[model samples]
Target: MEKYINAFTDSLLNTLDYTWRAMTFDVPWYTNFFWGLTAISLLVWLLEIAFPWRKDQSIFRKDFWLDTFYMYFNFFIFAIVISGVYEILGVLFNDLGITAKSFAIIDIASWPMWAQLLVFFIIIDFVQWFTHVLLHRYEFLWQFHKVHHSVKEMGFAAHLRYHWMENIFYKPLKTFGVMILGGFEPEQAYVVHFIAISIGHLNHSNIKITWGPLKYIFNNPVMHLYHHVKALPDGHRHGINFGISLSLWDYIFKTNYVPEDSGTIELGFPGDEEFPKTFWSQITYGFVKPKKKQPSN
Candidate 1:
């Protein structure tokens, strides 16, 4: 009996030790990423209920569990996938007669930490903006990006919903852009993404606040929802409002839209079509070739 009791006690202590490490460890970006997301999401959820765009929408809306799965999968597994791809590309660059050392970006660490942070934020946001535009302009890329827009009932977790292979299309350009400007330590980049993605969660969320004039500078729910609008607004036929965190890019490029009644529109693809409802299917969706249109007789 004592031996059995001791075994159980050891297991309990081991469990506690693991939990404490998870809560305390900061090496892997996901530890801080997960905790930061959790805390911000809780506050966002509370505000969502108190100042909701759609009062009828529940916290436990459709695909809630699936979105949670996406949040973890993208944050942990796919983040590692991105890192691996970045490394492989570095190897490829070396093979192509360009050595890794030759491509090294300036270590901008000599600048004030806050200045480095600001530069990274602006550059990363621009990279995101450019990558997002490409995803929409080409149907092949849209196959991956469309999974994100497939949500009928949007919420905080909706930001996390994405096709797994998106990094393949997005990361090379972004990494190159960052490298050209100045390569940051992993920690600096993480802080920038943490803010950028947090804003994304809030925009996708059901919370409806205009943020007054700040709407022109930063993306808000009204502007982002219009981005998800099935049809084009006013001028262009292809989708508009592709900005990630900053709306300035969209404004300068003439893709910005602010429908007077953003609350009334249905979000998702044209004709309100469906996407793969399952996580695995969504990840595999980009692999399926789109049908070519027949030539007119």
Candidate 2:
């Protein structure tokens, strides 16, 4: 309960920081991220255009524009939803008289900015890796996550092409984790997110760049591509290669699966099931559950 309260306090602080910064200076931390995302997307898209990992992959490929729409929609919807959540959490915490200034889990303030950033990032990434695995293994959660894997061809934009619920679930939890572990101010969050998103785009990108020895350190194109592969490794009920930015987590857990190649298997899940093709169907997919089966004699 103390940890949760701590997390809530930081959430409140972060929102106020956003509000104050934007109103006073007209540059919220999130706005910095929005522009950073656009620049990174453009750079990656240009690379994809010139030297695509799959040279056969086309710029006008199916759902290409759809992903762009998803990217833009994600920023808008995320800001709105986060603001609403922050307001509710803020009121509650204020009522309790808990605040970021009142408490902190650790004294990272004395640490160098880069060191503080790195430590907090690893902690959050671990939490995210765990959440991602849950989405793959759990039946109800998989319905939302299926939207992400539905993309037949992975691209940089595919990073944000997730069921909106996925964002709802991830963003709050990550913010909470960062808070309880060690409070993150808006400036700190902005720096870490830029690095995380840049790698995420590359991971989903159609680029053939190799990380070489860094493959063991950071999650790269090859490792992440295997994650989206249809087949799970033997004895694995859920998918493998669950790490995002860092390959180390999957390595420590033994969930990382990088074969000679991902093989020539189809993308998305391998089963009788096929996720919805259009945007609307994908968003509302959670409502359409499978019927219960009759008991056997």
Candidate 3:
């Protein structure tokens, strides 16, 4: 009887895996990634149409298309550039006699699949949250990251409106860190990457979610929306909700802000009031120094 039950559970897991692969067309890695991205984008769009956060009514204008185009453009460009660089680096690392085969933690790929997944996400989120905070506090890094914050409106595509250089620098470090630390194989890393990107996009989405108790565990769209809020003149309402996957760090660090009531809040950079509306302007302005303000006579 025990043997039969074990066999049944194994068969059920295999069946579910088969269904997932079938629905995804069992495509190549790159193709699967793109398709996953498209699927999530479509889901977010449908949610926006069905239940938008803001009732101001002009939120779904031509600006939406423009933002969407910018988002896709950045996503593809970063994917190509970062992947190419990582491939080259990986080859060099292989030639230099460095590999994950020597690492015990990474070799835990032999461990239970669920254990591997848990470790991968925890490590990645730790690195990402620290990196994100560094970008905000550091002036030079903020130049590139500001592009992400420049968005006045919150939506699905708003999450991807980042400078390509940000990815070129940030992604390589992240990939290399994972490879060296636990030696998480590229395929496992890829799966985690897809999940993280999907969740990050959803966090930036304008959809309303009650979340309830889950708010303490996972970051919902409503919580993340507050992170993009423009800073007050006195810098009182500046930084909050710095976590990417889990809200634990934010709460521990006193950065988490759970609003009593959900509502559409003002978003964007406080110092840079004249945010560029055009794609080129937005990307280029970050490179140039802002004009100095003249003191009132």
Candidate 4:
């Protein structure tokens, strides 16, 4: 108990310091997640302004400001909030005699930098893709995920407009992926992080990109737009196009779907009009049981 408390204190302070340096540009440029996210967002927003796939969508799209706040909240504020908990978890796992390297299936530490990054990216992307499918497959998870699907207008900022619970789900699985790769994160792993951010922003941006033949290899705006559609296909009750940074998983698993590229299809899920609009309401949105239909009177 004392150890956990100390871990919490130490992680909280370290997280604060890291966030400050990131914001003040004191960290190396490649590892400066704060500024890196900002730069990518700005660049994508500029692209959306110059060449919008949905020409009618506003520069200030619905929930644009809200989503912008979400980007920072999830990236920085939420990190501060969860740092202690994560540290405690690490301590607990260590006490349990389990370490990341315990699950090591391969040690790519000695692999070429490019190869290490490629394997890391592919494994992490698949993990995220699977987790995304689970988010839709389960009702309890979907309730939280509704915050993201609540988007009525798509844009670059929408990429990060998800419930914080998703971080709880994703981060652990991502760590497990690293564990599988012999718990060896390469020195240049930031490259994978930056590329994932760029692809994710582009995936949700209001800019058309199919990547031509590479559409099969990577997620793009067109394919991901369909992921937010109000209606699912006949058999896809959960969702479709579950890919994150990579579309290959969807194509391989037969979850990919894009009947047309009209770019005017309605976004949002059924009854999204009733979803919460405020940040506080949204972050806490999906934690309770719904009233049982009163036995249909």
Model 3 poorest ten-residue lDDT run: 76-85
- Per-candidate Cα lDDT values, in order, are 0.74, 0.75, 0.69, 0.93
* Sequence-dependent TM-score of model 1: 0.81
Stretches of candidate 1 exceeding 4 Å from the true structure: 1-31, 95-107, 185-187, 271-274, 289-297
Q: How do all the candidates rank in terms of lDDT, highest first?
A: 4, 2, 1, 3
Tell me which of candidates 1 and 2 scores higher on lDDT. 2
Clash list (residue pairs), candidate 4 = none
1-297 per-residue lDDT for model 4 (tens digits): 899999999999999999999898899998999999999999999999999888888999988999999999999999998999999999999999999899999999989999999999999999999999999999988998999999999999999999999999999999999999998888999999999999999999999999999999999999999999998889998999999999999999999999999899989998877677799888988775443335555
Question: What 10-residue stretch in candidate 2 is worst by lDDT?
Answer: 76-85
lDDT by residue (1-297, candidate 2, tens digit) is: 565566656665675566445555568545565566778899988887987777677886668888888886676545644564665665677679966544456656668888878877887898799889989999889888988888778889998888888876787677666666555554476777888888989988888755888787799877888888876778777988888789988888889877754323457886525556777777777887644558899
Model 3, runs deviating above 4 Å: 1-31, 59-62, 91-106, 186-191, 232-238, 289-297
Where is the poorest 10-residue window by lDDT in model 1?
80-89
Please report, as a residue range, the 10-residue window in candidate 4 with the lowest summed lDDT.
288-297
Tens digits of per-residue lDDT for model 3 on 1-297? 454455445555554554357446785654365567777788887777777776563547436777787766776544543443455555566767877544434454566777777777777787677777877777778788888887777788787777766776667556655675556653456677777877777787767774788787778788888778785333434467878877777877777775644655777877657666677776776676655659899
Candidate 4 Cα misplacement greater than 4 A, ranges = 288-297
Task: Tell me how far the alpha carbon of residue 172 in candidate 4 is from the true structure, in angstroms, after superposition.
Answer: 1.3
By lDDT, the better pick of 1 and 3 is 1
Candidate 1 lDDT, 1-297, residue by residue in tens:
454455445555554454445557633645466677677777787788788888788877778888878987786666644553455556566667765235456666678877778877877788889988988888888878888888888888888788877777677777766675544544556677778877988888888866788877888888888888876776666688888888889999989878584476877887335466778777888797544558899
